[model samples]
Structure formats: structure tokens, C-alpha cells
Target chain A: MAQKVVEEAVVAVTEPAVLIHRIALLFSPGRHWLLLILASLPAFSLFATVLPEDRADVMYHRYDGGGVEVDGPSILVRKSVMDTVSLSANYYVDSISSASVDVVSTASPYTEERTETSLSMDYLHNKTLMSLALTKSDESDYLSETGSFSISHDMFGDLTTVSLGYSVGNDDISRNGDADFGDQVKRQNYRLSLSQILTKNTILGVGWETITDEGFLNNPYRSYRYLDPLAGNGYSYLPEVYPRTRTSNALALRLKYYLPYRAALSSEYRYFNDTWGVDANNFELAYTHPFKEKWIFDIRYRYYTQDGADFYSDLFTRRAPQTYLARDKELSSFQSHTLGLAMSYEIKPGFLQFVDRGTLNLAYDYIHFDYDDFRDLTRGGVVGEEPFYSFSANVIKAYVSIWY
Target chain B: MLTNHRLLPLVLLLALTGCAIEPWVQPYERARLADPIMSFERDPVANGFRHHVYQTREAARGAEGGGGGGCGCN
Candidate 1:
């Protein structure tokens, strides 16, 4: 179900937090090693660099799954000034309609829309590049603003690149019908990455990121069921509660190899862990093939698995059973498999006089997700003995790009 | 913490030595790498949308060189 669709008039009265702002965890002792690594990177080398191409893209995307439908349009444009600076802007919108299980269980089916706008500027100096970006997203009851900065330098005679980045986000949450309900969440992210050209035909990249969030971390409109023998259905619903703060870390390794012929192969592995007692792994492989001079084809497969959070459960024993409680399926143990295919065709220059190059692209993906702890309650089976839940989704993207 | 201190000198030594190492793959030999087929991310718009989809559905996020977080999806 789309989290953006919440038409309920229910009042979400958030209680006082058991803990105060834990934003200080960003500088915890455990992060010293990462800081030292960043400090020890080599100085930049004097190498010539050019700005990225000036281009514009128009894309339409759709996702259909779990009785929810979402379709959106995204437009991005970038331009270069002189030879040192590149500026870009993006406008994105998502229109959502949902009648998923979560909505059918305790809330009414709803429709909603969210829009996001972002702008960024990149400056290239010698072999070093600096970038700054700002983004804002607005929905009926939620608003978020984020700002980010990053720097990259080419070292070791252009054989290696090192980058550091940081971003912060502030968000405001409000209830639809309750004018008095308001909450805020603050988030910070730290990133470090390296890209190395191992050989003429091979490249490798590694990245690590730490993200910390403090404040309201749960869905205000969602509820969890607890066993209540006194009730007719043997259960009662209460607003879901969650920890006030969360911290997560992710590390990823990627490799791309150019085949001897006219093909490229890529593989990636990522590991993730969080303070909420969740661990995850993701693996992916992809291949790209170019035919003649005007067409390219791509195929990819991905697998992901994760363990449930410590407080996640299908059904709780009683009300206020634990300090933190959640039945959100996203926090449950699950695995997913994805298969994707894409094709792109280059447009002849004679077709468009002003544009230097153009391409039309189409892509599709099919994903299957299986949950280990979350169950399908609509089956009308015994409580705690219901069958596990699984679903499949189809995603499509069609886009056009032009370079001038 | 003491172990990190001891290892710092070794790391510094290794990085300093990098300057002396010659480029193994010459610029002329990078033709294959320059090809569009070898790009890690070919379509930025499509790739960005894919990332958003997964981030909204899964508990795992970040470490993919993406920034800006204003998604109400999750």
C-alpha cells in the first residue's frame, strides 16, 4: 500500500517521548574510524576535467501491485555555464490510489498526490568537483526539506576517485482532521565512497553511509491489533508505537567489466544493519549490450533479504505489551526477487536539427516479495495461524532524452 | 582506539606510496571503458525512479551515492 494515501479523519495523539533528542549519536565514538579514513585520503592531482553534457529528460513511470496503483511524471533538465559549472533541476509528481489490505482492514480506500522539486549545481575545478543540492517535497499533511553537499577528487594520476558527502533533512507531520496534532523529525546522513579503475576493462566502486533519524518515526494513521478475548473478534486495535530514534548503516561494493566484444557486465553486493535489530543483504547482476550504432539492450536480476525488527510481530499478546510496538509489514522479515529488461534506440540527428543527440528508452521490471512473519488476515483463518503473505508487482518506465 | 592509532601510520605510508606508482592503463587503452555500454548507470531518470521504488518498499536504504531525502513514502 502507498503510505502517501491516508484519508482517515482519525486523531493521532502522540505521547511524550521516553527519550530526548539523540542527534548527538552522529558523533558517537564508533564513528571515529570512518572520520579518520576520510581525513587520510590523498590530495588531489592536477588533471583536466570537463562538465557533463547538457541534456533534458522526460519520463513516465507506473507501479501496479497489491491492489494499489501509482503513476507519476518526472522531468529533469541540466545545463552547463561557461566550462566550469553545471546546473540542474527536477520536477516530480506521484499520484496514488490504494485499496490495499492495510486500508481495507482499518481505514478507507483513498487517493492522494505528492510533488517534489529539487535543484543542484556542480562546479568542476581541475580534478576536483563540488556539488550542492536542495530538495522539497509536499503532500497534504507532510512536508520535507533537505540540503546536501559533496566533494570529489581524482587522485593517483586519475586512477582513483574519492568522495565525501553529507545531507540533512527536516520534516513536519500533521493529521488530516486534528488541527492540534503536529510532529517533527530530523535526519542526517554521512557518506564516503571510492571508485577505482583497476584496468582498461574493469572498474570497482565501494561506498558506506550512516543515517540517523530522531523524533517521530512511526506512521500516525496506522494501528496494530492485540489479543483481547473479551472482544467479539478476539482482538482490539491500537495506534502503533515505535522508538523515537533510529540509526542505520549500509556498505556496498560494485564492479563493472567491459566484455571483450561489445557488452558490459556489472555486479553489486550490499550489507545493511540498523539499531532496531534489523540486518539485510542485497545482490544484483546486470548486463548491457549495444547493437550496431543505434540500439542498446539491458537485463538485470536482483535479490534482497532482511530480518525483522526486534519489536515487529504479527499479533501482540496484550495492550501496551512492550515499550515499542509495530505491525508494519516493512519492518518484518522478507525477501524479494526482481527481474528487469530495458531497451534504448538512438534517434538520427537528421530528425532534429537543434538537438545533437536523442534517445528513446523503455524499461520494465517484475518483482516478487515473500514475507516471513506478516500474515494475510483477509483469509479469515485462526488468529496467529494464518498463512504468510506474498505479492508481485510490475513496474514500467518510458522516457525520452535529448542532448544539446 | 590504540589499534587505530597504530594502523594510521601504515595507512598513511601506503597512500604516500601511491604517488610513485605509474598508471598501468594508459589513456589510449581506455577506449572500452569510454563506451556507453560500459556505463554503470545509463539512464539517470530511470535509475533514480528504481531507487525510489526499492527504498520505499524495503527496510534497507543508502550507500548507493544518492542524496536528498524528502520521500513521504516511508
Candidate 2:
């Protein structure tokens, strides 16, 4: 019943995004090894090639008619003191020549040229609200560094607001591919927030986050080969967890409603627990309306579920596999559902200046990832060894922000 | 791991759904107004390019503000 084997594996992956709409026939090598096994990991090992001057994945795959051509360069600055303090800065840069991460398997997809940078500061007294930030990510494969701070108050006036924050990130990955889910990982997070309004229309937020992770969180370039006749290659070899350490806790809730003028309604829910034996829950919804005055409308829906990672295994393991390294994909702990539609058009092209503003946004998204413990690990290859590989993506973006 | 303590009475009964919102009190939102809503909507590089488009499609990321990217994925 796993939803009819995940709708027969997404009707068998919608016959290739509607079967060849052409982006050079959708760059295959197993769709670039499924986008290099989902963009080969490595975030806090600080893999730098000078990338981070603004690279929103090249601005959401920036203006494409296909056949791949992307260009992105971004920068931002903000300040408005007088009542208090506020300062901000952002920079992004990207240069990708995409061969889908230089195809050599182990989940390929990490074709260099990257840069990311971030800085932020905020301080406001009396009622309290504080912030400090820093981020740097450069990539040829991976590199990361992050710092964060936050504070908030207003608890006990019935309008409730409380926040406490912390962040630390470190990354290093790039020994050139072969990531079966091991290649360096370090993370630290602590957060607590509460926002309450309770009546005039429902505004609520609750959050508690705690994360402590240590070293090479796994993905050493990736691998999965099974050909067993009695371990003759029935597969089973994934040794390396790089000083693995994990602890996670999260509980989140958010709600918002307003039905006029800028019509709004929002929802969010999250629950998570971790220590290798992963468990996750996420739900989200959004509706934004603003038409005519520059037209704007947005709609969104999301749901995610997880449960897999006490060294999730598949390829027939009953007892001789306790995560001697794990990376068996079905995207581990499966369940992904998403539906989205967005539109934004705010133009102030009055020959620039007047606080130069311009925005154009269009989005369409549909996602489905489900695996009922797929378990097959290929023997005669019926696309099953736990077959469930479905992916669909679409994005369009436009930007213009000028403030001098 | 279960000191969600019955999640504090379901988070105080969902914090009574935080009574809805529409409180626009500016005069610089007083108290000097620093980071009012995460640095008053700081726009972390447009929310880090909307979080690199929600890590590759599928949308929805708290309209700018609070938390960001981390992956060991799974």
C-alpha cells in the first residue's frame, strides 16, 4: 500500500520530465547521477573556490531557455538607524561550468566555481532584539563557516515573544567524488523562540531547536554496489562515519491568518528527534494575495516525513550491518510531498532611483519522494534494488534592487 | 527525548493560536527597533536566495527570517 508503490514509482518518473522536452535531452547519466546524488554533500569543511558573492544556486537557475547557461552575481546593503541600530550586507558569486560535477559516479555533481559571503548586525534596545551573523562558503566541492546570534523579548504582556539563538557551522569536503554519504560534517545549533498573539486573528509561533553534530557527517563521495551470491558482491561495504556524533531536537509551530488587503494565511509545523535513528515531521502551507498595485499571488503546500537512519540499510541486511557506513538512498527515511505555485510582479522601473525596486517572480514546483523501504539492491535490474527515484524541478526568477 | 513533557500541554494549547496578527506600530516600532523580526527582515541575501530555492525546488521556507541551510541530508 505504500501509496501504490509510490504511484508505481511516480508512474515510473513521469517518463523523463514529460519525456525529453530537451535541455540537451535532459543531461543524462542517470540524470547526472540524480544531480550528483543530490548535490554531493560538504558544507562545513570550507571547500572554497571563492564562491559566495551571491549564488542562490545561480539565482534559481537564472533565466534559462534550457541548454544550460547560468550567471549570477549579487550584493546587498541596508541601514536605518535613528531609533536604534541596523546594518546588513550580502554578497554572492557563482561560476559553474557544469559537467554535472565531472561525471565519475559516486554521485558526481560537484563541478566547481563557487563563492558565498554574508554579514549582518542588529542591535535595538529597550524591548530587546539582537543579532550578529557571518557566513562564508567557497566551493570546488565544499567549504563552510558560519556564526550566528540572536535574542528577543516581550514575554508576559500577552503578546508573547521570546527568542534565544546560537549557530556554528563548519565544513570541508572534496577529495573528489565517491560519496556514499561520508565526507565531513560539523554542525552546532541551539534555538528557542516563541511568538504568541492568540486572538484578533491567530498568530502563533513556537520553536525549540538544538543540534550538535560533529565531523565528517558521512558521504565520502558515495557508493552502492550490490552483486551478492553470498557477499560475493551482494554488496555491503561502507566503512567510515568520520567521528560521527549527533543530537537533534526540534519542535516548531507557526500560524498566521489575515484575510484582507494583502490577504494572508500561513502555517508551519515541525517535530524532529535525532541521534542517528532519525525521526522527522514537517508541514507547511502558505497563501498570499495582493493583486493589482503590481500583482502578487502565492500558494504553497508542503509535508515531509522521515524515519530511517539508525544506519538505514537495504540490499538485504538482517544482522551484519550496523552502519559500517550508510548511504543507500531512497533518500533515507522517505516521504516527501510538495506542491507550489507562485507569482510576484513589483515594478518601479521609473528610470531607476525612487529607491530603485524591481521584482519579477514565477515559480512552479511539484515534488514526491516516497520509498516503502525499497530494498532490492539489483540482481537482474528491474530498476529495483529499492527503486524509487523521482525528481522534478522548475524555477524562474527576476531581480532588481537599487538603493543609493 | 520525550521531555517534550507532553509538549507542555500541547504548547499551552497551541499558545491559544497566538490570537492572529496585524499589529503595525511603527514610529520605528519604538524601543529603537533593532532587528524587529530578525533584524527587521534583514533579507539575508534575499533569504540566501530563498535558501537556494529550498535546496532544489519543492518550496516553502518561512518568508525570510530564522534558521538556515544545513545538510548531511537525511
Q: For this target, which candidate reaches the highest TM-score against the unseen true structure?
A: 1
Model 1, which residues run further than 4 Å from truth? A1-49, A349-351, B1-20, B66-73
lDDT of 2 by residue, A27-102 (tens): 3444444333222332110111111111122234342211223347666665545535666666676555432211
How is the predicted docking of candidate 1 categorized under the CAPRI scheme? acceptable
Q: Model 2 off-target regions past 4 Å? A: A1-205, A208-227, A230-271, A274-311, A314-353, A356-400, B1-31, B34-40, B48-74
Clashing residue pairs, backbone N/CA/C < 3 A, model 1: none
| i-RMS for every candidate | 14.3, 20.4
Docking quality category of candidate 2 according to DockQ thresholds: incorrect
> How far is A396's C-alpha from truth in model 2 (Å)?
18
lDDT of 1 by residue, B1-74 (tens): 56988999988998889775677864334556656666655677888899988988888988865443434445
Chain A TM-score for candidate 2 is 0.28
